[model samples]
Target: MKSILVIHHGQGVGGGLIALLGLIAELKENNRVHVLSIFDGIAVDYIRQTGATVTVAKSRFYAKFYQLFIHSDAAYFNIIDSIRNNKSVILYYLSKYYFAGKELKNIVFDYEIVYLNSIFISDWARASKLAKKKVVIHVREPLSRGLFKFKYEIIRQTINKYCDQVIAISHDNASRLDLQHKTTVVYDPVVTKNRSQSEYKLINRKFKYFVYLGGMARIKGFEQLVESLEYLDENIRIFFLGGESEYASHGLKRLVRQNLDPFFLKNKRLIDKLKKSGKIIHVGLVDDVFYYYENSIAAICPFSKPHASLPILEAFSVGKPVIVSDVKGMEELVDSTNGVFFINSDPESLAHKINEMSQVTEQDYEAMRTACMTKYKQIRERSDSVTSVLNRT
Candidate 1:
């Protein structure tokens, strides 16, 4: 059996973490697997439950360094701040890179293959290559063009030169970096609890609400989703199933909302009104979102950015249709057969599509549900066989 070292950059339990856990479960069936997490959190506990050995590098300095790298492209830095912190930032970057590489090189010598869970840790590919180990990177995020072009170029060149193979979560992500020749497109494996599990807590059998999975951040088109309720009838409602995101666009505004109450900060009066009227129920981060998906008429994904959402797959796994925004990577996953699309970032359009879906007849709805399962199976066929990709690497 091959020995694999899986390195994940984040500690939060999001879609990427879920995908990585699924991968580890499959890989450990025949191969020896070890996980190196950058920080310690509940995610580490989840990884341990997969029966894989895990090492938590809970480095506060490394955490800050990683955060800077992630948010460098954002408008978080001003000229004054840059001028004041330039020298210190450069020193910190160099020291962190060198020390981290040295530590990783020592850890990787025990494994035959080094698998990077995200592009953020692509620099470690070089250390793995130096150790003469096979390097495989799972490209989760789209390589967008922005202020971080130089950083992206470095990552692109690193993967092309040092990595043996690249596993992109979506075609749109691969095409962005122009790594088609070396990239294998593999959708994330979907995981769900059995139907015999307990029912949704707040939602009763007669509730007419759609489930919204994922973070409640502006980039996720959450604000637009909230506004869309204005157009829908008072009886129609939304059941938000996730919590606030770490990297949301407006951090200060979100903080204010958090201080006021953890549920929602945007459209405050409207949200309060909806909650009191039993029109909007925010169920933050449940252990099993499957019951929520099973009971809802459909799942709604209103992401403005390019995303390979897990909600669409999770919804389809239970024969539930989706109302997804027509954005890159996301739009490619669904069509008129099993799902309806709305204009990206347009709440009015989302509401219109929701109305259309709500009005679908019993016969049409059953057919759409069947199509949803069919689409899910087609994707699952690819996701389940990812062991072949590891074999090649």
Candidate 2:
């Protein structure tokens, strides 16, 4: 069987997981497939669901600081312990990779392909160019606003040359940076939830709820979206459902406080208000977001930040009216025909779009929803494209 190694940087339930799922679907067919995840999260559960054995780096701390001290004593011990016992991992990491960062002298792989994630760690592998291994450099986000100026040029430039192939979550993201040749645009795959989607159909006469999904990461424009809610009529509720980013969720919480003060009171009161008048549902990380989307009127992804996002697609897949910012990857997926796009990423513009959505007719909304599902199907079919490339190599 062909040998293939898959690496993941962080374990957020985002594009990486879908990419992992896609790769697993494609690469594991009649091959000795192995995975090395730098971090762990819900994605780990999904990866295991694919039935592939996951052999994480002995020291994931090595992923970012492997050259220095190995992070996660547990992982360090696991790898060392396994190696010392001579427990032969069918597919395994190189010794030096955990012990000596860039100094990782040699990697003995008879495999034809090494599909990798995280530009920080494995980028070195590509840079080392020790063998004829095909490397798939997966990038899910654009550099931060500050780094967008020039800070990333060094690393990105290196990626242009070192990487054998480049896979971006969206074409807009690929074009956003000065990437070199051999780049392919692969949209993030939709996570298929076992739970059925919400059956609540959006009434096109006027929107009742506005939705946004994603951990409250810095680039999601969380504060701005929450702040904008103050200007809109209280009749419409804005529901947020996603994990909160450890760093930025605090600011998002603060913004929520500001929006609710002197306005919304108790949960029962808010529920009653929404029932009588629409109110926001803060269902954090629901089992099936499609359920929420089906009930909701419009799926909102007005992220002003520079990164790829998935909520927009999740909303579209279920035929929800989507409203997003006309920036980066979002621009590629959302258009006036399929969904609404606001040029201005401000509260007023957002509120205006919400107001506009409130006026869409049922027929027009259905047409837009149909357009979105068509696009969703096209993207879904390409979900395993990266895995195909990795296995073929």
> Highest TM-score, which number?
1
How far is 33's C-alpha from truth in model 2 (Å)?
Answer: 1.8
Please give the range of 10 consecutive residues that has the lowest summed lDDT in model 2.
68-77
TM-score of each: 0.84, 0.72
Report the lDDT tens digits of candidate 2 across residue range 234-331.
56767777665342234775465445433223322433433342344566665566666777778877676545667777777888868777665666
lDDT of 1 by residue, 251-313 (tens): 785565455533344446544544564566777777577777877899988876766777788
- For all candidates in order, the CA lDDT equals 0.72, 0.59
lDDT assessment of candidate 2: 0.59
Residue 219 CA displacement from its true place in model 1, Å: 2.6
Deviation in Å, model 2, residue 369 alpha carbon? 1.5
Error of 2 at 263 (Å): 23
Q: Candidate 1, which segments miss by more than 4 Å at Cα?
A: 58-60, 71-97, 105-109, 193-196, 201-206, 245-277, 382-384
